[model samples]
Target chain A: MIQLLANPQRFMDFSKWAAPIFGILAVALLGTGFTLAFAVPEGVEGSGGSGDAIRFLFFHPQLATMSMAIYAAMAASAFFGFVFRHLLADAGARAAAPLGAGFTFLALATGSLWGVKTWGTWWIWDAKLTAELVLFLLYLGYMALLAAIDDETKATRAANILAMVGVINLPIIYFSVYWWNSIHQGSSMGGNHLGPDYVAPFILNMLGFAALFCALWIVRVRAEVWRRKAGALAVQAAGKS
Target chain B: MSGLGVLFRRELALAWGRGGGPMLALPFYACVATLLPLAIGADTGPLKAIATGSSWLALALTSLLSLERLFERDFEDGALDLLALGDEPLEAVCFIKCLVQWLATGAPLALAAPIAAMALGASPGLTPLIIATALLGGLGFSFTGGIGAALSIGSRRGGVLIAVIVLPLFAPPVIFGAGAISQAAAGLDWRAGFALLGGYSLFFTALGPFFMAAACRNALS
Candidate 1:
């Protein structure tokens, strides 16, 4: 499979088709997900249980789920690049950084918005928020490192190493919430904390967001590949002149 | 002594002798350290906090400012290739070079902290801890900065590139070093903070050389 995709021509062909399909699917899923997310019976928890259960979707659980899922996808792309030596895999990882970063920024932004509503403050130095901030910076750093290096081969390998290092740091960032008294909440997605009542829309949003990420990632990767090709051609033309 | 010792001495000599690297770095560190407090106003509490941080931050910046000179000259002159193929382990050589670098840049900055500390109105008791943390933290900066320097070899805009790659990793040291002085100033137990700084230094000290050497070899190849 890796060898088949290793050929740039084949990968380009695949992306030419895959990009549009994913983009269309992303639009559909995002439309459906948002409608369902907002349309869910409001104030269902109503004056009786846990203050307001409907508002829960707008808070930590959804954002945390999106952040982790994006990172997991990035890590998977990085692993594929590392093991299979696939250029598309590496390109996929490179392309995913900015998208993942955008999602992280969204998570942080929404979390802060939610905090302002609930905690009456714009920002809190809670462990989870800080860790997520660091994760965002890690993505920015990876992207910067890729842009900084001149040689394509060198940049890919350097960025790969950074992404792998970041994956290791992600767990540390997650666990730091427990290790310290941060303003961020503890795990809400997995284990005993995630009950069935909340799991449905959360999973829907995760799938929708993950698909959105893939759509963006495919578009970005195709753009990068084209840019590189154009750059090589320009260099060759200059040499010929 | 081993080949590492010989490399260490040679690097130290190159860094410290007349017209040596430290001549430029020492003045840079002094100027920056003095200029910061002036920029931030003379208030004692903030000054003292900035004072401690500026000590390590200045060292980190100066180390970065001078980092391109680390591998660029050697790389341009083809000396790095020889070192890559040399009998001594490149990792050990890398470690020694980092030590020499810290001595040349970080050591002077550490030594100069007291003057800046006084200027910033930091209490006398915090001076020793500031210097100690600077020394250890500066060593870590040198090691990590060397890796960034090595990675950016042969690249355009190497200076900015090195800074971007290195500054994030540099955060832990700055936090711990600054935290130590702040805790001490607050009359809390600063030993734990200093120990954390020391542990950070140890972690980077062990890990940096191998990664730096690998980066160098990759660049050379």
Candidate 2:
């Protein structure tokens, strides 16, 4: 499938239709997910019952998952771009970073709100929270490197290397933070702590967020493709003049 | 092999002469140790408690001081091109550069680590462990930091960009290094943190060169 869409024109054609479909799907799923989650009465999903604050589960986890999923996808695309010399792969990697960062930020923000509701604190240096924050920093670093270089190709190449390094280091960073957290003994929200009733809406919102991400990623990649093509044409025209 | 030795020595000399040896980083380390207590209030109770951890934090930040010039100088002077075209692989050159980086800068910083920690009111008995962890952790820093330096070789914003790129990578070492010292200070088994720190440094030392070389080639290209 990647080979079929390796050509920029094919990607452009595919995304033109695919993007809208995904966007519509995202809206429909998110709409349904939110309605279902809110319909569940306060105090129904947990022992201590966070009331309406339980709705954050539908949003926060999905955004956090998307944030991580996008980084993995971005790194994979970067690897292909660096190794196979695919321009579209590079463009895809570049387009995904800001979106990933946005998702990560939302995840952190929502997680913080959830904390305030349940844990009575706005922040704690929990293992998962620290790891998410580090992931956000990684995204920022990737974007900064991409923006700092003047030459587009060099920037892409450098950022690709950084992405690869970040991916390799991600697990180590997570483990280290977890180890440190163990010594400090922070409370973590375990999977078993939540009621099974919350699973359905959570899955729905996760799917919705994934679809939304796909739509945005395609649009950004298309924009980059067009921008590069326009630049090429302008340079050619100047040479003739 | 002889070429690598020469490269190692040459990097050491360049680091010492051009970058002011460890003069820049040591003072920065001391200043951080000094300023941290002042900022947090000089109460002996709190300062004594955070002594080792804060010193580890300072070490991490101090390592960032000389990284901006790690590859940028060779790159700007056209020497990186020569190194790339040399008979030896660029990966080996990167390894040697990072090794020399540790020797010239990281080692001295490690030596200064215990002093800074002691000044911060860490127990004096923790001094040897502090220096040991700092030495190992600094190796990890130098190697991992070499990747950031190489990646930011031709970047417009060198220093801050390097910090933003590299600081997250510094987390593991800082955790392990500080954790080890704190474990020892509390008289728990410190071996686990020390072993983890060693493993982290070894892992980076083994793999960091390939990434650094790749980044350098990308910048050079």
Candidate 3:
């Protein structure tokens, strides 16, 4: 299947339309999700305006989950690149870094805001929050490493190794943080604690956020592919001259 | 493994050479430990209470400082290519290099951890545990950090990049090591933390080489 897309022309043709379809779907889904999320009856109890904000506050975790999912996706793509030595996988992995970082940041920021409202602090070294921050840094490091290298293949290969190594640590980080959280004195925020009425919008925003991620990922990969093509063309023209 | 002993000795020697040895991290750690007292107000009681934990943290951060040079300096000076070409597999070479780093960086940090802890006002009773945990945890940091250093070889900025990649990966060891030190200080059963630290150290040293070797290969290519 990857071989079929190996041809740049075919990839361009397929993604040209597919990318836009996903993008439009992403915007529409997000729009509807947010609208539905805000439409819910305001307030958790006595917090008044905060209740409405807190109602959709679960989106923070959804964004975080998507962020990690993006990193996992990025790692898997890079792993394929490592195993198969395919350029598309390289492009896909490279393209996902910024998007992953963005989601991770949003997750943290939203979580922080939620914390200020709920926990009365902007930040806490709670295991979940800390782990998400680390993951965000990982994304930043991946992108920084990619940009720092002038050699394209070398950059991609090094980043692939980092991503793969990072993926191995992901489960460890998650479990360790899980254990750490259990040991700590946290006023634990479990998913089930939220009202049953809020579950619908929570799940909706989850899918909507995921759709937005996929849409951005597809478009980003296409852009990287085109950039590489342009670079190759310039090199070719220089050689001819 | 043909020249394993020779390679180890040479690495140890090179690690000790002027401007490259373990001394760099010692002073940096001291600086970090020094700042804590000032930051928290130098009340000896609080300082003593937090000393062991802060010392362990200082060890982790200092090892990180030393780790950025694990592969980068060698790669830059062309020593990495020669090592890669040698009879030893790159994986084994990476293992040995990280071992050397552990010896140079981790060993001293461990040795100093006792004094550092005491200086920060920790009781003498917990000194042994602090030393032991630092030794094991430093190896974990060294090995895991070796991967980050190797990965950053072809990249321009490495110090911060290595920290970014390595710190999250360092959490387990940090928790286990610091846990052991603090538990020992508190006169609780600390053996579990020690066991976890040992597990983390062994795990990272065993698997870190593969990624380190792979990253070095990519950087070389």
Candidate 4:
């Protein structure tokens, strides 16, 4: 699979059809998930669940998972780019960052809203929440590095290194935050044990969001490939002139 | 090894003489300490509660003050290229630079942390723990902050960019260090936080050079 996509032209061709299929899957699964989620009678999710706020379970957990998953994907691509000197991997890393950031932001927002309904506050210093906030900042830092460097090749290399470093640090950050939170106070929020009915829709929504992310990532990587080609062509034309 | 030693000494001199040495960082640390009471009002109750954390915050920011020019000055003057081509690996060179950065800036800031904490109404009894944690945490900051400094070498908005990149990386140490101090003040077992702080510093010290070296190479290329 890596060998097949090593060529930009081949990857572009593959993604042309693949993106649309993923998009269709996303729409169908998300539609079904949402319909089923809403069809459940209000205040009847899991035992001791937070009423209608439990509906957020459908969207928030999936978004939160995708947010972390995308960072992993981004760092993996960055590792490939840094190690093998693959430009496509670099492009993939760049393409995934903003989408990851968006998912992270949505996760935070939706989670905060859920908190408001259940915890009676807009925010708490929960370890998971703090780690998610750090992840969002990490995304912003990545995007900023990409924007600040004038040379595209250099930017890719620099940002790739940063991504790899973040991957190494992320677990440590989570652990530290968890430890810090534990020492400060006991978390009032208990874990939600999902019932059998909530599981299918939750899985469906997660798959839908993953599909949507994959589709968008394909499209963005394709765009990045085109942008690089154009940039090279412009440089060539300038040199000739 | 000898090459690294020489380079280390050279970087130490430059870091001290060029940037006003500890003077710059100390004043900045002092100002942050001074500002906390002023900004939050002179109530010792609230100030004491935040004292250790605020000192850690100041140390982190003060470490950042000197990082922007960590590699940029060398890169601009072509010293980085020379070092990259020398008998020493770029990794060692980066390690030396960050060590000097810690010794010149972070070390002094670490020493000042207790004073700042005390000024903010932190109990005088917490001073030793505050100093120890700050020193280890400073080591972590220098090495980790070096990665950010190296990454932003040729980029625009370098100062602010380094802060953005480094501060998130700084979070773990700050939490561990401040947690240790606060835990001690509360008459609780502080060993876990202190051990974690040491582990964080050691981990970064071991691994940060590779990242910094790679970033420096990226900028050089």
Sum up the clashes in candidate 4: 0
TM of each candidate vs. truth: 0.79, 0.97, 0.93, 0.97
- What's the lDDT of the predicted structure labeled candidate 2? 0.91
Q: Candidate 2 on B82-191: residue-level lDDT in tens?
A: 99999999999999999988988889988898888888898888878888999999999999999999999898999999999999888888888899888898889999
Error of 3 at A57 (Å): 3.4
lDDT for each residue of candidate 2 in A37-120, tens digit (9 for 90 to 100) = 887656544433367777787788899999999999999999999999899999999999999999999999999988888778
| Candidates 1 and 3 compared by lDDT, better number | 3
Residues A116-187, candidate 1: write the lDDT tens digits.
655567787676676777777777777887887777777776677666655654664455333333212453
Model 1 Cα displacement at B116 (Å)? 2.7
For every prediction, compared with the true complex, DockQ reads 0.28, 0.89, 0.68, 0.89
What's the DockQ of model 1? 0.28
Q: Which lDDT tens digits does candidate 4 get at residues A55-100?
A: 8889998999999999999999999999999989999999999999
Residues B62-179, candidate 3, lDDT per residue (tens digit)? 9888677778878889988999988889999999999999888889888888888899898888777888888889889999999889888867777988887787788878877777
lDDT of 3: 0.83
TM-score for candidate 1, please give it.
0.79
What is the TM-score (0 to 1) of chain A in model 3?
0.91
DockQ of 3: 0.68
lDDT of 1 by residue, B1-221 (tens): 97777777878887887666668877887788778867987677787666666666777787786787778778898988988898988888888888788888878877776667666677787778878887888887887788777777777777888787777667666666777777787787777667866876787688878767766776776
- Pairs that clash in candidate 1: A126-A182, A126-A183, A126-A184, A127-A182
When summed lDDT is taken over every stretch of 10 residues in candidate 2 chain B, the lowest stretch is B18-27
